[model samples]
Target: MTAPLIGDAVRAPYDLLAWLIGLWSDALAAVGDAFGIGMLDYVFMHHAFLVGGLIAVMAPLVGTFLVHRQMALIGDALAHTAFAGVAVGLFVNSLLGTGISPYVTAVVVAMLAALAIELISEITDAYNDVSMAIVLSTGFALGAVLISLNTGGLAVGINQYLFGNLATVSRENAALLVVLFLVVSIVVTVTYKQLLYVTFDETAARVAGLNVPWYNRLMTTLTAMVVVGAMQIMGVILVAAMLVVPVAAAAQVARGFREALLASVVLAEIAVIVGITLSYRYEATAGGTIVLVAVAVYVGMVLAGKLQSRRDVVEESGAVTGGMDATAGGSAED
Candidate 1:
């Protein structure tokens, strides 16, 4: 009886977690049904929306640091590398009858690619972009070659991976996105100060006795994880847009680094929700739609920032003119 009770206690949290997930899933289904949207009627659409929302938050959260460090293109490089990983997984599965998920392979490959980029930069005294270019070209070339072989006949839906499709998001992938989001959020929260210090000034951080190399690796690793998570929906070509656009838009008007980070998340969330809705209505590509929305938001922010600056300048000019007129009037009266 004691052993049974202990087992039950150990299982209680897991049971509760399952119950909550079920509840949320049902709730989302109900909302979809109520909306009477054709696309939302399918469970895959729900998964896409959920995954999109999660990526919206995670991308910008990580992107804030990436943007500050001038490593924005690293996202693109990692994404292409993840594409190679996907190809490898598909090839292996087809050839050896392995049942591994492509995403698992993608994560592994992307992390390796990221480490390689860092290593090359560290060892050869090369610029970060140069290293990234080398990795990007090699990864994409491998992916293309593997895809061209196509001996496994697994290239049937390769377009979906390259361009993304709304129906391609499965429940399993959505769950994976949730896990990635939690991991990224926790890591960022825990390492916020150190990351901030390193982002602004790596030399200063090193001078202060911080482990700069470790944090650099950590940042790149986190970026790779994010790239793989996002690849399911954003596809190979446009996935990096999510990682950079929102942060750039937020930087246009943000008062500080933290503010930019928070604002970027908000902007990304808006873009995701709107883009998903629009894609559903039009039966369009989810990845392209989301990226288009993000780009629109970025342009809007840029325009708004310009207008605000102009207004500030005009206000200052008016104040100066008013002061000059007052001074001239006072002198004449005296």
Candidate 2:
């Protein structure tokens, strides 16, 4: 009886999962039928859209702090390192039949690479960019060599990692993205105030008795996690764009730090949805399409900012002229 009870307990979660999946599928189908759109017709398309939406929120969430700290290029650096990790996973699987997923290796390697970047900066007193450059070069070099050695094996699906394909997202990978999104969201929420302090003024945070180094490490680790998760849809080359572009566009119109963070997430979601729709309609690369949409949003924001500034200046000038005329007329009457 105890054995049977234990088995039932283990199976309960699986039963719930199946029920949730069924409910979600039914909802998706009903929406599709009503709207006459085929976006969720296939399982892979559903996974792609789910993961893309998660990336939209996670990327810009981390990106807001990265932009403030001027560490925008760390995304690109970690992405290259993740590419190398993927290469290693592929090579090892091909050589030893380990049956490991490249994405697993990517997360591990990217986390290690993130630590290495911080260590190198601390030990050598190098600039963040310098550390990033060293890691980026070495990582890409190793990936290229590994791919060359296992050309017949790794070359087959390598393009999907280099340039994302919405159709290639599997259910397992989408589940991983969901886990990553939850983890990132929770960590950021818990550490929001501390991170804000460190971001704006690390020295002041340290003076206020904060563990500056720990927060720095935490930030980089989170960035690596975000990179690995986003790499599924954004690819190695363009994943960094999601991190930087949305934050930049948000900065143009945001009046404060918190506003920028929220605006960036909103902008990223817009870019992701539009980009995914366009990619599906035209059969284009999802990563490139998303980045291009982000760039267009940035340009629009810039134009709006400039126009707003000009209007403010004109209004201020008219106010000053009106006050001067009123003062002069009052003096003349006196």
> Against the hidden true structure, what lDDT does model 1 obtain?
0.85
**TM-score: model 2 vs. ground truth:** 0.89
Q: After superposing candidate 1 on the true structure, give the runs of residues whose Cα lies further than 4 Å from its correct spot.
A: 1-21, 33-39, 313-334
Displacement of the residue 8 alpha carbon in candidate 2, Å: 15
Considering only N, C-alpha and C atoms within 3 Å, which residue pairs clash in candidate 1? none
For each candidate in turn, give its C-alpha RMSD to the true structure in angstroms: 7.1, 6.5
Candidate 2 per-residue lDDT over residues 66-154, each given as its tens digit: 98999999999999999999898888888996767788888989999999999999999999999999999988998999999988868
**TM-score of each model, paired residue for residue:** 0.87, 0.89
Q: Please tell me which predicted candidate would have the highest lDDT against the true structure.
A: 2
Query: How many Å off is the CA of 120 in candidate 1?
Result: 0.4
Candidate 2 segments whose C-alpha is farther than 4 A from its true place: 1-22, 314-334
